[model samples]
Structures are given as C-alpha cells and as structure tokens.
Target: MTSASRTFIDHAVSKVPAVTLGFWIIKVACTTLGETGGDWVTMSLNLGYLVGSLIFLAGFVVLVSAQIRARNFYPWLYWATIVATTTLGTTLADFFDRSLGVGYPGGVSIILLLLITSLGVWYRAEGTVSIESVASARVEWFYWTTILFSQTLGTALGDWVAGEDRGGLGLGYEMGAVIFGAALVVVGLLWLWPRVSRTALFWFAFVLTRPLGATLGDLLDKPVAQGGLEFSRLYASVLLLIFIVGCIAVLPQRAARRASAA
Candidate 1:
C-alpha cells in the first residue's frame, strides 16, 4: 500500500459517538439517571453529598481510565463513563453548593470557571475543542474533564432555577425543564445556520441538556408539594437506566470521524 494511504487508514478514530438525535436522547436520559441515582445514594441512603461524591468520583476515575486505554470506541463503555461524570457531578455540586454554603450562584460561578479553564487549556494544547478531535488519550482526558465541569455546573444551575431560596429564580422543576429545553431547541436551530460554529453549539447544547435532565429528574422525584411527582428516586433511576440501556442497544452509534485538514 502507498505510504499516504497507510497513514490515512491508520488515523485514530474518535472515541466518542457521532452527534445525532439518538445521541441527545441518550444523553438526556443519562443525565436524568445521574440525578436520580445520585439522590438515591446520597439522600435516600443517607450517605450525604461528600460520601456520595467520593463514591462516584472513584467510579469516574475507573471508567475514564478504561475509556482512555481502549483503542476504539465502545458505546457501552463510553456511555458508562458519561453516567459516571453526571453522577459524580451531582454529588460534588451538592457538596459545594450546600455543604460548603457556597450557594447555587457561587457553585455555578466556580464550576463555570473550571469548565472554561479546561476548554482554554484544551484549545491551547490541541488547537480545537471539537469532539471530533478526541482521537487520543490526552484529548479524551480534556474531553472528560470539560464534561465533568459542565455537568456540575448544570446541576447547580438547575437547582438555582428551581429553588425558591438563595436568590433562586423560583421557576420550579417543571418550568426550569421547559426553559432549558427551549434553549436547546434554539441551539439546535442555530446548528442549521451555515455561519454558526458547530463546536460552540455542540457544547452549548451539551451543557443545556444536563440541566434539562436535572429538572426533569427533580420533577419526577421531588414531593408533589414541591411541584414534583414524588416518585421514589430508586424507581425513577431504574426506569431511566432501562431506557438508556435500551437506546444504546438499539441505536445506530458510530465513532465520530476525524476532521479533514483545512
């Protein structure tokens, strides 16, 4: 074979799924599961935020290490890593916002700073923040780090919008979900515009979907008096888990292709 052809064939594929409708569907489901699952461990089991964070963080480390070591994309492993991030993000955000008394606004600010810093460092090192660039272990590290921060930020933001105290917007869980969902729709519409930056839109939508899932989770599990269905967190989590697994089993997921050089 020609040297150039060999090089082309040998290029590393991204270890992340292609962006598609199914991708977003599973993402939202996983985020919702994160919320309920985290609550199950922390609130239902009385482990509290700190202990829950530690537990999920351990899982995050394990799964992320496995993801980075894999030579190619494994859909189940990739999605499991995402779930770990979301669950860890939930408890960690709670620890900072509630346990540390930082409040939701403070938590949001801190996490947003972390997210931006991760992205800035990633861009400086890799010259691109696109998911398509996540073809190497180093880039995968940056991707997961950024995702962790985004998930944490989304939890705090969702709580702030839904809560009635600490200068919260008092939208309640249902309304908060509506607002974030609308924002995602807008982001999706922007994706169709030729001049829009897809990388930016993808991240924006990615961040928004977390809070959308968060609020939906809250709506399902919180007390009816608090504008929720008061469903058991364990039950909600199990149902969401089933749905996510089903989607992963049935959906057509493909590893994102590396972008051609401009």
Candidate 2:
C-alpha cells in the first residue's frame, strides 16, 4: 500500500484502547493487582524475585506476541498484556533493587535511563511517541517496551516511598499514596491548562498511576503495624482482578484514533 493508504488503514484500526476515565480506572486496578499478585508469587509462594520475574517475563512475551498477531483491538487481550508488564515490573524491580543490592535510587536511576532510552529510540524510529501513533506491530513493540520500563520505574518509586522497611525511605504507604495521587491531580490540572502537551501529560498520568497503585497495593497487603491493613496478597489480587474484569465488561472499549505516519 502507498504511504497515504497505509496511514489511512492505520487510522481506522488502532489496536489499543482509547484513553478515557475508564481506562485510568482499569489501569490502576491492573497495577495494584500486579503488585499484590507479584508479591504473592514471590513471597507467599517462596519463589525468588528472579524466578517470579522470569515467569512473568515469559507470560508477557506470549501475551505481546498474541496481541501483535491479532488483527484488531481486543479489550481483554490488550489489558492482559498490560498486566503482564506490571507484574513483570514488580518482580523485576525487586530483583534489581534487592537481589542486586541496588537501592531505590539505583533502581530508579537504571529504570529511568532505560525508559528514556526506549522513548528516544522509539521517537527517532517512529517520529512520534504518542499513543495516537501506535497503529502497527512495530510501534506496538516500542509501546510495550516503554511501558515495561515505566512500570518498573513506578514499582521502584512506590516501594522506595512506602516500603521503608524494604530499604525505602519509610514514609508509610498512606503518605506514598497521597504523594502520587497529588501528583496525578497536578497532571490533571496541567491537562486543563490548554498549553500543556497532551502526549506528555498522558505519559505523566500513565507512569504516575503505576506508583499510586503500588502504594495502594502495599497498603492493602502489609501488616497493620507496618501501616497496612494486613490483608492477604492473593485475596487482594483476586479482588482487584475481579474489579478490572467487571470494569472492562461494563465500560466502552474503543480503539484509539490514529495519527499520520511520519
């Protein structure tokens, strides 16, 4: 197909979901479940972070392959891939931070570098990093790679802020949640300013949601003395999964509109 025809085809059939309030809601739930579920597999099941990461990494690869192979947007499939990234993020962050003896600062710095590198390369290759340009499988690979890095960064940030016992700053989960939540509100305000970059804001919001969910998940599953409610990680994960599935079933699922291929 000609470039114009290819761009037109891409515009009509984006394989990702449109950004909406519902999208944010589901995203938060997915991230939270990722935290709890990852912890369950790593801690509760007695698997090391390395093992957990490898397992989730395998799942992520399989899911991404399926997502790319599909011809159209599939709500369940897309979200499943997202969850894979988040879970992989959780375990990978832990492995990097603890097992490798890199504290939060080191973990964040490493992951942030990776995230920036991914975005830089993607932009150089695709001309735009906006979700609007995520139409083809090549772009989808870039999108998911960027997402994995972002999720890992969020995992480190949240754990650093809340899980002080885990070599973090010990600010407590509530405070961590408050901090990330407030940042998100600020991003929302910027979104309303009319001069802010929508693509920048979207990524800000997307990365912020992961930490918010991380803190929330920690609060749900940590011991009361540690400032959490002491819930079972498995149970919390199950509950979050149910909520995510319900929202996906109830919410409007639409593909994102496309931008001209550069």
Candidate 3:
C-alpha cells in the first residue's frame, strides 16, 4: 500500500479500544475525575466560576486542537481531550445552573437540546455518526461537539438527580451513580442484542457516560452529610490523572485509523 493510503487508514478509526467495557470503565473514571477536579479548580481554589470556566474552556480548546492535529491516535492525547471535555462540562454546567439560575432541570433541558441538535447536524452533514468513521476534520468536529454536549448534559442530570429541592429526585450521589451505571449495563445488553441500530446504541452509551461521571464524582467528593467521602477534589483529580496516564502508557492504545481517502 502507498504511504499516503496507509496514513489515511491510520487517521480514520481509532486503533485503541472501541468503546468496549474497558473503554467505558475508563470513561466513567475520567468523568468522575472531571467533576471533582473541575470543582477543585473552580470552587475549592477560589478561582471563581467564571474564571474556572474560562480556564477549562481554554484547556479544552488547546487539548482538542492538539488531538486533532495528531498524526494518528495517541491514547494519551485522545483521553486527555476527553478529560478536558468532562472537566469543562462540569464547570460549564455549574455556571449555567447556579450562576444563570436556570436550575438543574432547565440547564439539562437546554444542553440536551443542544446535544440533539449537534448530533442531528453531524449526521446530516456526514451521512454517518459512527465512531469508526471519524476520518476527517468535519466528522471530528461533530464528534467533539457531541461529546462536549454529552459531558455537560451529564453534569446537569447529575445535579438534577442529587441536588436538594427544586424538583430534585434527591437520590444522593452514590445512588445516582448506581442508577446510571445500571442503566448503562442494560443499554449494553440491548446493544449486544441483534436488531438494535448500532448507531442508536452508540449514542445511548455516549450520553449515559456523562451522568455516570457526574454522579460518581459527587459520590467521591461530597461531604458525608451529603453522602460523599469529603475527599479533596484536587487530590481526586490528580490521582485520576495519574491512573489515566499510567494506563495509557501500559495499555495497548493505538493512534486513530488513517482515512481511506488519505
């Protein structure tokens, strides 16, 4: 095969885990970390919500740009971008819910709508939303946009479930995590069963990951009074970062598949 052709293949599909069980496990971990870590920088550090959002948003842009510019899939780079998205999601959602006074439900509703719009546009423009076909900038743009929304939506939903009062289900953080996790398992089984639209299943899991992270993160860092461990957010973020980096180094993470057209 020509070097050019080989390169294209490398850029298309990810050579890393294809949203498998391991992938979801790591994804959930990162999301939870995103919650704690994001709060650490924004709330704990006294960065202020606006400042924190700007900081994370900048980081998200930088990491995502780097990921996009990469020659192929680098697990570390890709996952870093994912973590960035989740962190930004946490801050952004909080800003909307608390600062804007939208409340959790309203914030969630808005983000969910945006998320749907992003997916619809992506599908309309690309004719496919499969993770396997993330070959070009256009497709990648859609993928990232959708991801950003999902992460944000997850935070909002987490708050809606665990947040006290205001129509809150008041499930608490741990219970919320369990509920979302169980839902994910059911979705997985349905995904495995034949006759389900693969695309639909993919989106379902993608959306679920965000809330899973949100609730899980809350479970880790919330006070005992609120049903959390009262762990330090900074410590949790740093630890999660370490685990992700170590796993990337040890595991078999491949670069993105090259585009067929490349």
Query: What TM-score, computed on C-alpha atoms, does each candidate reach?
Result: 0.95, 0.95, 0.91
lDDT values for all models:
0.89, 0.90, 0.81
**Which scores better on TM-score, 1 or 3?**
1
Winner by lDDT? 2
Q: Which ranking of candidates, highest TM-score first?
A: 2, 1, 3
Give the alpha carbon lDDT tens digit for every residue of 59-156 in model 2: 99999999988888899999999999999999999998999898887888888899999999999998988887776778889999999999999999
Clashing pairs in 1: none
Residues 31-124 of candidate 1: C-alpha lDDT, one tens digit per residue: 9999999999999999999999999999999999999888777999999999999999899888888898988888888889999999999999
Model 3 scores a C-alpha lDDT of 0.81
Q: Distance (Å) between predicted and true CA of 158, model 1?
A: 0.6
